[model samples]
Each structure stands twice: as C-alpha cells, then as structure tokens.
Target: MFTHAGTLQHKFCSVAQCGVLIGITIGYTTTTAMSMAAVKRSNCFHKYGHGAACHVPNNSFMVIFAIIQIFLSQVPNFHKLSPLSVIAAIMSFAYSFIGIGLSVAKIFGEGIGKTTLTGIPIGKDFTAMEKMWKILSALGDFAFSYSFCFVLIEIQDTLKSSPPENKQMKKATAIGISTSIVFYMMCGMLGYAAFGNEAPGNFLTGFGFYDPFWLVDLANICIVVHLLGAYQVLAQPIFGYVESWSKEKWPQNKLISKEFSLWGYDINMLRFVWRTSYVIVMTMIAMIFPFFNDFVGLLGACTFWPLSVYFPLEMYISQAKIRKYSFTWIWMQIVSLVCFIVSLVAAIGSTRGLIISVQLFKPFQSES
Candidate 1:
C-alpha cells in the first residue's frame, strides 16, 4: 500500500495525496485513541507533541537545515571566497556531518539509556557528557513531541466548536494524535538503530531513514518547501486576526489590497514573497546555526517546551469549559509541569556542555 503511495508521491501529486492520507489517518486515529482515552479520562491530549507535528511536512527539512546552519554561521573565518556564499555551502557540508554525529548519539545513546534507566544493563563506560547528551536528547524528543500535541488538541477543539461531542470529531482527534505518536516512536527507534554510535551532531542526523547524500539533497529541497508552508500556516491566522481587528477598529483601512493577497495570501504572492522569504530565512538559519545537533537542545527548550508543555496545560485547564479542576486536571497539570521542568533541565545541561566544549576548545580553534 505504501509502495503505491510512494509512487503517487510525484511532486505535485505528493502534496495532495499526502494530505488526503494524513487527513484520513488523523480522522481515524483520533477517533479511536480519544475514545479510549476519554473512557479512562486520562490526560492523553499532550500539547507539545501536536505542535511538533504542525511542521510535519518541513520537520525533516528544518531538522536537517538547522544542523547545517549551526556550523555554516561560524565558518567564514576559516576561509574566504568570492561572494562569500560558497563558504556558506562549504560550512553546510560540515554541518551535515556534525548533525549526523548528533543524531547517532541521540538515537543510540538515548535508546540505550532509556533501556538502562528502566533497569536494563546496556553498559557502564559512557562518559558523563555522553550520558548527559543521551538524557538531554530524550528530553528533547519528549519536548519536541509535546509541541505536536498542542497542535493536535487545538485542532480538535477548533473542529468541535460546539461542545465537541461529535463522534467524527473525536475519532479524527484520536487518529491524528495516535498517528503522530507512532511516527515519532518509529523515527526515534529506526534512527537509533542505524546510527548506534557514530551519529550526526543532532536529532536531524538520527532520522535513520536517509543516507548523508540523499538526506542533504532532500533537506535542501525541504528547506524551501517548509519555509513556504510554515509562513502560509502561521500567516493565515495572523492575517485573519489582523484583518478582523482592523475591520472593527479602522473601518476605512478595512479594504485589504489585492496586492497583499498576491504578496502572501494570494497564489502569486505566496509563490513569490513566501518562497523568497522562506529561502532567505532558511539560508540564514543554515548559515547561523550549522550544528543542528547542538541546537536540538536549544530548540527543544525554547520552541518545543513552550508550545508543548506550557501551552497545552494552560489550554486544557484554562480553556476547557467542561473539564473542571478535578483529579484528571490536577494529574495532567502535574505531569505537564514535570515534563516542562525536565525539558528545561535537559536544555540547560546541553547548553552548559556546549559552552564548556567551546571554552575548552577555544585555543584550538585554528586547528579545527
């Protein structure tokens, strides 16, 4: 079935086909999972996990590009070239290697740690930093996944605007959530299996499915696509709210120009400005933070944690009309709080380690 799906994923057809499949998958997965979760009244509607999924199409690209960006941003002093852009591309290659290492460490290291943390004996020779990285990576994963959960819950709530008791909506929610969870687990497992020890510098390298050459190539393409997609998704709500607010406050300015639509909301504008901005931002990020592996910790702490752990609980407790501050609410809140704390600690640890590494290697900069 997936073979056929892959064959159908030819450029333009891929987007439409993927959307249909994703929608169908979300619809069914949400229904079943939510139904079961509702029966048990478990706080399964994690927010972060969903937020991560919001960038599903471009997650791969961001993961890959972010790693490259970390290194590329610093490589200018290493060598000078015409236009300076060539140096950026060179740095990107180095960044890819580092990202691979990080990914390897994350998947294998974290996978082994999780096993041992549960009382299984994997090994005892791991260094303090290695152990720390493993733990931090797992925390990053959870945090990353949590953001995706936020998106899921919000989507469900929006879909079920009136009381949200419809069977179809519930089913869709369950399916979406479950699908995301499964995809995450599989990616983690497969990546860990492949990289074992010589992983990329970050989670992106640990994706496990793609080799370095293909990964980079695909990532380059995805960078462009993702930026466009993200802008579209994020801008829509912004534009809607802005337009609405403007209409109410300044009736004279309520007349939105057709050019603005062409700039973004319109097909021509979307293809032009969004595409250009997407490339520029991605290029900048790639150049800035070339070491995606290092950034994973930061990204998880800054972006993922806020979206997943913080927002979801706030949404559930503060927004849910029927969900009073009962046992479920309290338990969910506690869990969310713990997850956030853990994410913060892991991020701090990773950052500290990186800082120390930089400090120790400061004198050896030219050698590197």
Candidate 2:
C-alpha cells in the first residue's frame, strides 16, 4: 500500500492514515520485550527458588532490559541489525525444536490420554457460555499469533528495489508463514499432549527435567537473546518516524543529527534521547499492565482487522479500479464488513475478559 502511494510517509499522510497505529506498534514492541525479560527472570526464580540472591525482581529486571534496548535501538538503521536479526531467527527455531522435542519425549514416556488428544480438560465443570468464551479467547490468541500483516509492508521495504522485488517478497512471506504454521502446530499439539490441563502460558516454565538442565538454560538464553534483537528490529520504525519529525520541526537544531564518539562508536544525541524515552515509556506501561498474553490478544483484536483484512482489500479495490457493485468488489466488501464486525466483537470480548481476569472491574460487586 505504501509502495503504491510512492512512499510510506505519503501513504500515512493520505488515505492510509495511521499515526496512532505506529505508536501502538512501538509501545507493543517494548512491552513484548519487557514480557520476555519478565519470563526470563521468572525462570530464574523457578530455578534458584524465590529468595535466592540470583533471582531478580521482575520490574527491576525489566528496567535493566529497557536500558539494554535503548542502546540496541540506537543502531542508526535497520540494515545494520540484519546480522543480529538472523541470529534471533535461528534462536527462535532452536527453542521451538527444543520445546517440541521435550514435549514429544514426555508424551511418549507417559502415554497419551483424553486430554492429550482433545486438549480439553475432561472433568471441568464449565458452563456452555464459559466454554464458548474460552474458545473465543483462544481464537483471539491464534489471531494475534498470525497478525503480522501490518508489518509486511515494512519488511518488503527492506528488500532491494529490483524488478522482481515484489515476487521475491511474496515467496519469502510464503516460506516464512508456512514454516511458522508447521512449527506452531507441532509445538502446540505436542506441548498440550505432554502437559494437558497443566500447561502454563510459558510452556518451558513447566519443564522440570533436571537431568538436562543445561538444555533448558540454553533455551531460556536463546529466548532472551532473540527478544533483545527483536526489540531493536521493531523499534527502528518508531525511531525513523521520531527522527524525521524532529528534523522537520527543528531543522536548525544541529543536535538532531549531531554525532559524538562514545567508546569509538558514533551516536546521535537526538536519536539516543527520543528512542530512550520511547523505551522507558513502554517499560513503564509493561510494568503497570504485565498480563502479556491478554495484552497481545487485546492489541490483536483492536488492530488485526483494519491492518490485515479491511485495508488490503480496500486498497486493492481502489487501486485496481474495480467497478462498483461488481462481483469481485461486492464480494470483497462483504468480506471486509464481516471481518470488521468480528474484530469489534473480539475487541470487546478481549477487553471484558482482561478486566475480569485482572479483577479490575466487578459489575456484580454489590449483588453478592
């Protein structure tokens, strides 16, 4: 869409208006990093016991992680981070394989049962409505897992602008999506097979295989490393936007692009300040809200339809000049409308679920 509009800035200024969406992306990126840091710290608590000196408080560790992210965020441009990004991708695959391997081993040794096959708690006394809500919640989470369309344009922008760039991007996207689906299904099915109703949000957390403690430690380390790099990758766009805005507003301010040598690395003062502030703000939000999965579901519900479904079809319809009330255009419009309705309901359901889960809102407080 941005490419069709000449430039991303032009697209944002025109029909693809979404300044707030970019802000949300940046905020979500840092919150994700904070969640990863919190999980890593929790692993420490589990390994060493709560009171051990090595165990760090979650908020404190998040702050430390935020500081690390601030530096990572200052890496000038996206291309410079490609090496680390590749490593992060590998780490992701490594952890997924370890998780699947562990789960399969456990399932084979313990024998499969009803929960392993169905993944539904056999004796739960959940009402039909409650069961429906749980299914919807899971659907919301699954949607979140596949919600990367918003960033697809940005990723495409990274590719070399050659004649076949678009074709190359489509192929790359197909491969990445196919691989992710396979891995997700394998891990989800096998993990549930191993732990069933006992599986926690972080599957690795439930592992107590002391005989292979190093493998678990390695997996946790990979997660931390991957998140650190992932944070920088996501922060780059926010940094670009902020830097461009600052330069436009204060072209006379030499400090906006002033470079100072820091430990032999040249660092821009404005870039450092604004990116650091962004990370700090996100870190604070993460500390306050801390429900990682719920937050992801809520964010996904709010943005997925517009970013992933409605906009793309609308853009195509407009760009291709599809005749009004024609079959293709009408069918696309119908699909988009249905998606919009679904997204709205998901957003409301996710918000209500979050409030209830957190005990922040009680509609029947006086009834009982």
Candidate 3:
C-alpha cells in the first residue's frame, strides 16, 4: 500500500519484488534437485558403503522438478495456491524437525565435532579468503531465511477485521517471526554443535548423518515435497505479472487474453507456453549452477537489501512521517545503512564463491 501506485517508487518496488520472486524460484529449483539427489545418494550409501561413489546427475532431477512445476503453474492464480502453500509449510516443518532431531542424535552419539571460536582455521585446505566468504555466505543464508516479510501483507489481508486487522497482524507477525527465529536458531546451532567447523550448508544432504538412513531419506522426501509446492508458490507472482502484462499489451490477441475450460480447469494458451518456457529456463539455470550454497548466498545477498531492508524502512518512514533527522528516523537509517553494507559484502563473497564453483563445475556431469 505504501508504494503509492503509479509512482516511480511503485515501479522500483515491483522490480525488486519480481527479482526476489525469480531468485526464489531458481533457489527452490536448485535445492529441490539437490534434495532429490540426496535421497538417491542416501540409498546408495546404505546399500553399498558410505565411501562408495554413488553420484546422481542433478540435471535429470532438476528437469523432473521443472516438469512438475510446469503442470502446477497452470493453476489460475496466486490466491488459488492456498492449499498447496499450506501443505508446503507443513512439509517444511517436518523436514526442519527431522534435521534438528538427526543433529541431536549425532551430538549425543559422537559428541560434538571439532569447533573453534573463529570457525574453520586457516590451513592448507582452507584459506583466510575462503573462510571470510563462508562467513558472509552464511549471513546471506540467514537473511534469506528471515526474509518472509514479503508475504506478510498478503497474509494480513486474509484476516477478519473484527479484531482490527493491523493489531491482529502485529501480533501474528511477532508470534510467527519469533517462532520461526527460534526454530531456525535451534536447527542452525544444533547442526553446528553436532558438526562444527566442517558443518555442511545442508545438514541432511551433506551426509552429516548417514546412518538411520531411512530417516534421512524421509527427511529428504519431505524437503522434495515442500519444494514441489514451494516452487509454484514462488513462481505464482511472476506468472501473474507476466500474464497480466501480456493481456494488457495484447488485449485483442486471443492467444494472450482468451481462457478455456478443460475438465473444470481454466487453461490459457499464454500461460501454458510462457509458464512452461519459464520453468524450462529456470531448470537449465539450476543445472548449470547446482552450487546450492553459492546460489542461495547470491540470491539472498542481492535481494535482501532492497526487499527485506530498504523498501520496508523507507515505506515505514513515509507512512509514519517521522520527522527529518529525528531519533527514530536516524536509528532507522543507521540500521538500513548497516544492512546495505552487509548485503554488499555478502554479494561479493557469494559472487567469489560462485566463481570458484564454476571453475570446478562441469555442466550436466553424470557424477560428482
């Protein structure tokens, strides 16, 4: 609401939101494929030995995920995705708990893995630069995790006005965000404590806990299910934007504007062609990078400043009409500045990491 429709600020905000949406789509594609690979790898390790080479090609999995998304994207619009989103959220919680539980088991069984205050030390295997990159990338991951505010407004719109929507939303945001933070911290801290400096970016996929292989497979399956729904949830905004723009631009074109019924489902030619192509392109990008950490860090760092920090702060200031240079205004500005710097450094670190990953990566490689 604060964007003030038809203004330049609205346009910029739209671009930022779209950037975030696309970034999330790509990130989900990459992660879901990895989860699929992890499930197969888990079975491989169980059947054979943990040391045996059981490499799964990520490209195939990515393509399969894209195909599923292509079918799901045909759903009329974002609001129609409520059921899928709910299911996805449930799956998310399932995997998060499983991950934490696995970590706790590891800590109890093996004791804590080696740890240090400064994190992984400078050695022949890891350099100071790499270490810095890791720290920044980790910050990026945190930023991404907490960047759920983008949907806060939409969620608030769904609440009844009997309780005062703003007040209700305030309480909801507080409770939801606090609960999420605790869960995230628990999972992160426990994972770190269980396996310290060598902690994997994805505890489940990293094979940090190989045994109880069935549980690992189940967790990975939850992740895959979550991503299946999440990929469409994230893609909906993009599809809405493109489809709306196309209709307006080509109002008379039947291909863009016409809708038909297919067994109680609304099918539009533009949506079919455009959405399918979009998924395919995203799948290819996922296959090409397939460096989960670097991609997450890059997306999180690049979008976090504008979407999660800057725009919200600016909107709040404008809405609140806080006096210029007032204490509140100044503090808000300081926070924004700090966040911007964090985003910049994170972007640089993730970029450097992505470069290194690319140097070592082979596109569509069948084996690790």
Cα error, residue 133 of model 2, in Å, equals 3.0
Winner by lDDT: 3
Q: How would the candidate models be sorted by TM-score, starting from the highest?
A: 3, 2, 1
Q: For residues 1-368, what per-residue lDDT tens digits would candidate 2 score against the true structure?
A: 44444465346433322433443444454444444544555556667865544433456656667778777777666535447657877988998898888788788888653373434543557666665666566655666666665345435545776758879888878877788789889987777777776665666643423225557667766777777776666556557777898999998898996789989988888987888888887777656655555666677776667666766676687689899999998899898888777767676767767777668733212100
> After superposing candidate 1, which stretches have Cα over 4 Å from the reference?
1-130, 149-168, 201-231, 239-286, 303-306, 314-330, 353-368
lDDT of 2 at 252: 83
The TM-score, computed over Cα atoms with residue i paired to residue i, of candidate 1 is: 0.46
Clashing pairs in 3: none
What C-alpha lDDT, on a 0 to 100 scale, does residue 287 get in candidate 2? 60
Per-candidate local distance difference test? 0.41, 0.64, 0.82
Clashes of each: 59, 0, 0
TM-score of each: 0.46, 0.80, 0.93
- Candidate 3's C-alpha runs over 4 A off are 4-6, 149-165, 261-265, 366-368
Q: What's the ranking of the predictions by lDDT, best on top?
A: 3, 2, 1
